[model samples]
Target: MSGTIQFKQDLPPKGGYEPIRYKRNLPARGPGGLAVFGGILAICAYGFYKVGQGNLEQRELKRERAWSRIHLIPLLMAESDRDIYRREQAQLAREKELMKDVPGWEAGKSVYNNKRYNPQNFVVM
Candidate 1:
């Protein structure tokens, strides 16, 4: 007998190992990770939206201020005229009262002599 050893194969031919396949049924929001991600996204979106809204409000306020400035001259003049008219009316009323008391007293002098005409005594209300 030769000094070589030979064995007969009775088993089937061997092949490389095949990877195992498994069905994945994991939820999209597993372990709250998706929920946390969504929350972060929502926070960032809201922040951006608030910034945009603030910018819009600031722009509107600036525009209103500019508009008011442009129209302020006429409004101020009208207000001054109205104040003057009121002052004249008040003087006339004081003169009428003084005329009823003194036959020939001027209304302007009566108003000037009235203690209530003191600037300190004038209350806006």
Candidate 2:
């Protein structure tokens, strides 16, 4: 036993605790390396490129459909209007023939409104 008890704090050895050994000490056993990292990066890049291409293609298809609707809608509306006018004309001719004996029944006369051309809509639906 010492006459006076002494307390000594533990200290690192020389060379500052062997440079701390901060790097991983596990064995290089996994299937990973620079080559694997590079391959994974390349695969991710390709996947992103394919996704971008698909998005672009989808956008183009949507644009085409939109343009087609823009061009066709008016033509379809005109054709439908023409068909309605033709049917009305046919009905007027039948009425003129059937009501030949009756008078004051004017054919192709506006009964509801005085406007010759009714207002049309431009909705996409």
- In lDDT terms, which candidate is top? 2
Model 2 lDDT-worst window of ten: 116-125
lDDT of 2 by residue, 9-124 (tens): 79887766655567778887767798799999999999999999999999999999999899999999999989877776677687678777878877555555767765333211
Weakest 10 consecutive residues of candidate 1 by summed lDDT: 116-125
Backbone clash pairs for candidate 1 read: none
Computed on alpha carbons, the lDDT of every model, listed in order, comes to 0.74, 0.77
TM-score of each: 0.34, 0.43
Query: Which pairs of residues collide in candidate 2?
Result: none
- What's every prediction's RMSD, in angstroms? 11.5, 10.1
Q: Candidate 1's C-alpha lDDT?
A: 0.74
For residues 1-125, could you state the per-residue lDDT of candidate 1 as single tens digits?
Answer: 89588888686447855656677876665448788899999999999999999999999999999998988989898998899779777766865765777766665543365566433334222
